[model samples]
Target: MSDKMIHAYSGDEIDVHWDKRLCIHISECVQADDPLFEVGREPWCVPDEVAKAEVREVCERCPSGALSYVDKDGTPEQPASENTGQVVYNGPLYLSGELDIEGAPEDMPGVRFRAALCRCGASKNKPFCDNSHIAAGFEDFGAIGQSGPGLDPGSAASDGPLKIKAIPDGPLKMEGRLTLKAASGRSAWQGTKTALCRCGASKNKPFCDASHRAIGFKSD
Candidate 1:
């Protein structure tokens, strides 16, 4: 999907905005207790149908940062206390924390707190996942890899923004504190920086093994 803004549902207590471009249709909102978010109805999102708190809760679960809610009181969604990345089962990398995605739109709410990044190297949307992995038949068990340097148990995990830079036709260059976890929620790697494979050809799984070059992956 192309980068663009969509409709906003304004309620008395909150305003819910949808960026359809980033949505991979995870269906978190559609499954909420309220009918505020439905798939086929016209004006699919009606924030007034749900409580303000529930709207925010549903929006936060959106991995693609496609949904966001603004409280009338001026309070914004806060980033997760700990920077973390989860390798989805044969899918994108889901990140939660203060995120600084290179070249991402600055005005998109919740974009800084959550993102679903393409790891299958087939997304026409580039850095963001567009559910292209499924059609491309990308397969990975999402297992924890060799342990990397981790922060001491007593040390505080950095509460700073994780900078993600998509290298030209290469891996995702991640900087800043982050704990990369497997699908089982087990820590696989922890560090301030790492290069993650996006070409779906790395023998080392998540980590880059220079396979993109070998496969002649074209990201542009």
Candidate 2:
């Protein structure tokens, strides 16, 4: 996958954009709505054949932010609020609202409304979930206190840029303008600095429980 390349498919009513490098090959686009993302078909994506709303729905389901769309009517589709994230039970870290992944290539779309990040540390697509947790038998109870102090969204609002930096062989260091939520939609914490466990061994997950140190988790 070329990190700098963006493949775009323009249709009559909408345009579908894809960043191949960000795709984890979860097959959500092909499985959810095959008519638009047929693998063997010429041009592969036939956005004209499907309704604009249908195409947009599938794009939103893409966990890696590899897929996105723009309506010809000029209605904005990107999320326009504070960033938020949640820990899925025995699964990926679900993120929503406005987000900015730090250090992404200039040509790539740096911001997104939603993303399912891989927490198991087994994903072939490092940062994004490709449903590898299920295959890897990852186990987590999604406990509340394990995540640390909860942040009040109303109180933590700041104009700083949201940043997520993947440290070499370490946790995902998140800083600036973000909220961490539980599965129940309750705020777990809101802060400028939070280190999320990426090696899947954190007992205090989704926070870094220091298991990465004992397990010798190496991303590099």
Candidate 3:
């Protein structure tokens, strides 16, 4: 027990459950190759292609907890058997037991792994980024008046939740817990922490789907 942790990366393989507190903003996870570290996206890693040992080695090499094993969900059960007991189902991804991500030995220790991030900007799911606003275009202004399975955008602000803003003509800018509602059908998602679109321009329906990219979405 060195009392210190390490975080390592090699090519496009891991998301590196980042610990902003312990991390110095090193660009390793943000720099690695493709499919493994899509940067600005969830599942940041493609572990199958990369080896756990190699990842461990990289972590061992880091002076910071940047690559530390805050939680090993993306990995397998056998390899990270110790982590199995800590696994907690989180709908989209598995949450490892309270391990440690940013703690410098005494702070609230915990690790986060294989998380679904918010690409759409509408995520009532805190820390968890659901790709909703993206699927819906979610204009900045549009976010002002919308309802989802577990959220009512018009009123979420009063709850001290994240706020939404149109990027001028760009994708909606959501900065807090967001929820999404059914764009159609018999309301499959009854009540779940999610995010939907306001722009109503997402090809993925209620989600943003990044169609804004093709449709020339800008918020300037």
Candidate 4:
């Protein structure tokens, strides 16, 4: 704990990125209501700004490995995982490192859902990955999903719904009893099914306008 330190940085590291695994469950970093860390959307703790002793106290309390820190020089330190030097993809966010389709949630009795989240603001089906980013030539090298809802594990439901399947190197394949919503707050629940965009390049806001294809949005 004494050896731990949190360094302060200028705005030069704006390009610094963090994914799900890197976090240390240091809820303070992500808590906007009272930002103690002041560096992230939610604040946690920064050692260099404060005292080294205080930073170690906070880091030691983390329940999950959700929080991590970077050095002043911009180099990264290893976390406490047995798997070292893994080649993590910079894009196409996967849940706990699992592919999308296998754990996708079905619309049903369960509360969880399988919807895409938008990384770029160019998605017609923003927050959901639709192929629109690709069709529209929307580029998101650091982007992932760019369309479609996240997949959940276990269970399935069927009540005359539009079925969604994952296409290889394409937008999500949806065909079933589902609805599409527009930016105007209007919704189209066409039980027939539609492929929504996860890439945020859609002029359509929430539906897959196929703009990603035109934009050439690719999830690396």
Candidate 5:
């Protein structure tokens, strides 16, 4: 996935930019308003067909930051909140806010307001979701465990650069202000650091329950 491939769609008040490599194919844009994002049509997206506000709202919902829009005034839309992550129901781990993903692909954005990281262990795009979870029938309820003390809601609000270190063939070690949420928008866990499972073999679901070692899951 070359970082140079950027698809731009112009509108009356806003211009939308899409990085196909970052797209997870969650269909959030299409579901928001099909007329503007018809799958089989040329150009695929017609931003002018919908109100600028509506288009912006839909684009913001993209979990992978694959969709971004620039207003006529040249202002770019920002993330809704601070550094945070949410485990989608039987899907990828959705993240947003100030983030610095270490060791990411050269083509990937250095920083993004949102991203969908693969937790299902099936995505061809490592660390990023590619909608392979759907075809793989991945399932998880994102249950929290009785581990160490998690972060307080107030503490989780700190605006800091979240650091995500992807371990070669291992779990994702994260540090900095973070609020881990569940599918129902409930806080499952909040902390400044954590080792999250990526092999999808953890008995603890999102957490590293040491199942990766037992299963000998290799990723490097």
Candidate 6:
């Protein structure tokens, strides 16, 4: 297991794990009425402060895949039934389903469910968003534009692994089925393969416009 992984809280029924490296501070865990996560507390996250169901709900809502939990007897966290990539307005790409992120660290112990990937080309953490888009003043309305040539209808009846390859100084090469959507929850694209922009210079927004080459964006 990764030394950086935080075993935040554990109890007879559940255990909470936090990956600091992946957190972008979306604040979902701290917004509940009872508030399982308190900023000033020594442990910060006290699963005992709330019910197991509430803890799991908040953790599942973490788009960055930073928070996860294990249950002793109840149903555990599972991968999404369908693969999806949701474009966040002026922010990262939120991906869910069975994901196989190329070069991602595998030492952390948790259920692999989701990830927030960089789109602004300014993240110190390449491929993963570190919320650098806000500082960089990256602006994208997160609207749907061109779509990939889709597969036969019902081809995606079952969830499959979505492979994301972060190309050096280029785009995120996605392989396997994906249902890409805009921030408004509208379908943007449906396909098995596509190259998404990491460089903020893409005129096509979510899709690569070869702007990485012109802007000399470096992923390393």
Tens-digit lDDT track for model 5 on 3-113? 466788998888888888788677898887447788888988989998888888888888898887778976677655667788888888888887788866544442367
Query: What digit string (tens of lDDT, one per residue) describes model 1 on residues 13-64?
Result: 9998888788998899899878888889878888888888888999898988
Residue 168, model 1: lDDT of 94
The runs of at least 3 residues in candidate 3 whose Cα sits more than 4 Å from the true structure, single-residue gaps closed, are 1-16, 33-35, 70-103, 106-220
Better of 3 and 5 by lDDT: 5
Question: Where does the lowest 10-residue lDDT sum fall in candidate 3?
Answer: 81-90
Model 3 TM-score (2 dp): 0.25
All candidates' lDDT scores? 0.87, 0.76, 0.36, 0.34, 0.77, 0.84
What is the Å distance of residue 164 in model 5 from its true position?
1.3
Give the lDDT of residue 162 in candidate 2: 63
Give the per-residue lDDT of model 6 (tens digit) for 53-77. 8888888888898898888786878
Taking all chains together, the TM-score of candidate 6 against the true structure is 0.90
> Where does the lowest 10-residue lDDT sum fall in candidate 1?
151-160
Per-residue lDDT of 78-117 in model 3, one digit per residue for the tens?
Answer: 2221111111112121222222222123431222221222
Question: Per-prediction RMSD in angstroms?
Answer: 2.3, 3.7, 17.2, 14.6, 3.1, 2.3
Give the lDDT of residue 218 in candidate 2. 83
* Candidate maximizing lDDT: 1
Ranking, TM-score, top scorer first: 1, 6, 5, 2, 4, 3
Give the total clashing residue pairs for model 5: 1
Query: What are the TM-scores, per candidate, against the unseen true structure?
Result: 0.92, 0.75, 0.25, 0.32, 0.83, 0.90
What TM value does model 4 have? 0.32
Better of 1 and 2 by TM-score: 1
Q: Pick the candidate with the highest TM-score.
A: 1
| lDDT (tens digit, per residue) of candidate 2 on 57-174 | 8887776677888789997676647677778888888776667765665555523566678799988776767678889999986766644444455554455456778887889988
- Which stretches in model 2 have alpha-carbon errors above 4 Å? 2-7, 19-45, 49-54, 71-76, 146-157, 184-186
